[model samples]
Target chain A: AQKVTQAQTEISVVEKEDVTLDCVYETRDTTYYLFWYKQPPSGELVFLIRRNSFDEQNEISGRYSWNFQKSTSSFNFTITASQVVDSAVYFCALSGEVVFGAGTILRVKS
Target chain B: DARVTQTPRHKVTEMGQEVTMRCQPILGHNTVFWYRQTMMQGLELLAYFRNRAPLDDSGMPKDRFSAEMPDATLATLKIQPSEPRDSAVYFCASGSGTDQGGYTFGSGTRLTVV
Candidate 1:
C-alpha cells in the first residue's frame, strides 16, 4: 500500500513572500512517482511537477522549487515571491497503479 | 497541444437518480484515470484503464459505481443510485504510459447530489 501525507491543511502568506508546503509519502515499491498539482478557484487541477524515486536532485522552475529527500521521504515545494494568483489548493500525490493524496490549501494575499 | 476533454461539466441530481460522466483522453495516450475530489477527500482514484483494458478499480465502490472504457478514446463512469455523499467534482486524467510526467487532466465534472 502507498500513502501520501500533506501535513499542512491550510497556509496563508502575504504577497511576494515565500511559502513552503510539506509532503511526505510511504511506499514499499523501489520505483514510484511523486507529483505536485495545483487546483485554483476555478476547480481545474494544474500539474506542477513530477519526480521519480530514483531522482534525488532538487528542481527549480521559475518561481517554484522542489526538494526531494529520499532519506526523510519528503518532497517539499516552495514558491518564491508568490502573487495573489498563487492562491490555490496544492496536492502531493504518490502513484503506481493508483494515486492518493488529501492536499494543502495555500492562500496568497496582497 | 493535445488535451483531455470531459462532458457535462456540471451535474445536479436527486437521490436514486442515475448519473454518468464521460471523458476523452488525449490522442495517442494509452492510459486513462477517473478520480473524485471533495473538501474532505482531496482526490481519490476511482478507476483506471490501460490500452482500453480495465487495469485497477480498487478505489471504487463496487456496489454503485462502474467504470469502463468501451473503446480507445472514450471512458465512462456511471453511478446507479447516487447519494448526497457522492456529490463531488469528478476528474478524468490521461497519461502516455506509467511514467511520472505522462499524465494530463481535464477540468472535471462537478456533480452535486441532493
Candidate 2:
C-alpha cells in the first residue's frame, strides 16, 4: 500500500515568517513520483512541483523551495517569506495509486 | 493553457436524491481522474479513466457511485442515492499519460447532500 503523511494538520504564521511543511511517504516501488499541490479558498488545486524518485535534487522556486531526501523518505516544502496570499491547504501526494496526504492548512496572517 | 472544465460549480440535493457531476478534460489529454475532498477524508480518488476506458474504480462505492467516460471529451460521476456523508467537493483532473507528473484540476463541484 502507498501512503503519504502530512503530520501537521494546521499551521499559522505571521507575514514574512518562514514555514516548512513536512511530508513523508511509503511505497514499495523503486521508481515513483512525489508531488505537491496547493488549494486556495477558491477550491481549485494548483500544482506546485513534481519530483521523481531517481532525482533527489532539491528544488527552489522564488520564495518556495522543496527538499527531497530519499534517505529519510521525506519531501519537505518551505516558504521563505509567507504572505497572506499564501494561506491555503497544501497536499503531498505519492504516485502509483496517487495517494494524497491529509493536507496541511496554512494560515499566513498579515 | 488548456484546462479541465467541470459543470455545476455547486449542487445542493436532498438525501437519497440522485446527483450527477460532469467533467470535460483538457483537449488531447487521455487520462481523467475523479476525486472527492472532505474534511475527514481530505482527498480521495473515486475513479479514473485512461484513453476513455475505465482503469481503476476500486476507490468508489460500488453500490452507490458510478463513474464513466462516455466519450473522450466527457466524464461523469453519478450517485444513485447520495447520503449526507457524500457531501464534499468533487474534483476532476486531466493528464496526458500515466507518466505525466502533474495533472490539471478543474475548479471542482461543491456537492451538499442534506
Candidate 3:
C-alpha cells in the first residue's frame, strides 16, 4: 500500500512571500512515482510536477519548486514569491494500481 | 492540445437512483482511470483500464459501482442505487503508458446524491 500525507491542511501567506507545503510518503516498492497536483477554485486538477524514486535531484519551474528527499521520505513543494494565483488546494500523490493522499489548502493574499 | 473529456459536468440525484458518468480519453492514449474526490477523502481511485481492458477495480465498491471501457476511446462508470455517501467529484484521467509521463486528467464530473 502507498500512502501520502500532507501535514498542513491549510496555509496562508501574503503575496510575494514564500511558502512550503510538506508531504511525507510511505511505500515499500523500490520504484514508484510522486506527483503534485493543484486544484484551483475552478475545480480542475492541474498537474504541477512528477518525480520518480530514482531521481533525487530537486526541480524548479518558474516560482514553483520541489525537493525530493529519499532519506526522509519527503517530497516538499515550495513557492518563491507566490502570487494570488498560487492559492489552491495542492495534493501530493503516489502512483501505482492504487494511489492515496491527504490534501493541503494554500491561500495567498495580496 | 488534446485532453480528456467527461460528460454531464454536474449531476444531482436522489438516493437509490441509478447514475452513469462517461469519459472520453485523448486520442492515442491506452490507459484510462476513474477517481473520486471529496473534502474528507482527498482522492480515491475507483477503477482503471489498460488498452481497453479492465486492469484493476479493487478500489471500487462491488455492490453498486461498475466501470467499463467498451471501446478504445470511451470509458464509463455506473452506480446502481446510489447513496448519499456517493456524492463527490468524479475525475477521468488517461495515459499512453503505465509510465509517469503519459497521464492527463479531465476536469471531472460533480455527482451529488441527495
**Residue A105 accuracy (lDDT) in model 1:** 87
Candidate 1: segments with Cα more than 4 A from true spot: none
* Docking level for model 1: medium
Docking class of 3: medium
Fnat per candidate, as a fraction, reads: 0.63, 0.80, 0.60
Among all windows of 10 consecutive residues in model 2 chain B, the one with the lowest summed lDDT is B95-104
Q: What is the lDDT of residue B33 in candidate 3?
A: 92
Ordering by DockQ: 2, 1, 3
lDDT of 2 by residue, A2-24 (tens): 99999999999999999999999
Listed per model, the TM-scores of chain A against the true chain A are 0.97, 0.98, 0.97
lDDT of 1 at A79: 98
Residue A7 CA error for candidate 3 (Å)? 0.6
Candidate 3 residue B78 Cα shift, in angstroms, is 0.1
Candidate 3: tens digits of C-alpha lDDT, residues B1-114: 889999889999999999999999999899899999988877889999989998899889999999999899799999999999999999999986656563688989999999
What TM value does chain A in model 1 reach?
0.97
